[model samples]
Target: MATGKKAKNVGKGMKGKVKETTGKAVGNESMEMKGKAEQAAADAKQAGQKAKDTMKH
Candidate 1:
């Protein structure tokens, strides 16, 4: 896997977690939902990268 891309996905996942936690603490349902979506997208991206790397090997 590309180190830069992998780091980006990890960063996105971390960012989403912060957003979700902050939103919940502040009672912002919309923000929380957005955070969850972001996390899911990051997870998917990471999975795709892993699969691609596996195929290459």
Candidate 2:
């Protein structure tokens, strides 16, 4: 089972993906780029957290 923090990060990443897709579908370039950036950041954060947790073991 995934921890609560991991689940939350995954949810956030999904939300970013939805925003990005919606923005692109609506032809809003700015919003689409923003969403994409947010998604990348969220992914990086999640990865970092996972690395940190692994080091604790």
Candidate 3:
């Protein structure tokens, strides 16, 4: 289900944001970078889904 996938991705993005913030607060560069990458991947997936939905209509 597209809706379910979209909601999951949104949650992933929010989680990534939290990870990135916490890493920064703790001075952990690796965790920060990983979080950033996760956010980027989630964003890309969301964009792809949006395009697919647009095409469907």
Q: Largest lDDT belongs to which candidate? A: 1
Model 2 misplaced stretches (Cα beyond 4 Å): none
**Candidate 1 lDDT over residue span 1-57, tens digit each:** 899999999999999999999999999999999999999999999999999999999
Give a tens-digit lDDT track for model 2, residues 1-57: 248878888888888898899999999998888888878888988998988988888
- Candidate 3 contains a number of clashing pairs equal to 0
Model 1 quality (TM-score): 0.97
Lowest-sum lDDT 10-residue window in model 3: 1-10
Candidate 3, after superposition: displacement of residue 14 in Å?
Answer: 0.7
lDDT-wise, the better of 1 and 2 is 1
Alpha carbon deviation, residue 35, candidate 1 (Å) = 0.5
Stretches of candidate 3 above 4 Å error? none
A best-first ranking of the candidates according to their lDDT comes to 1, 3, 2
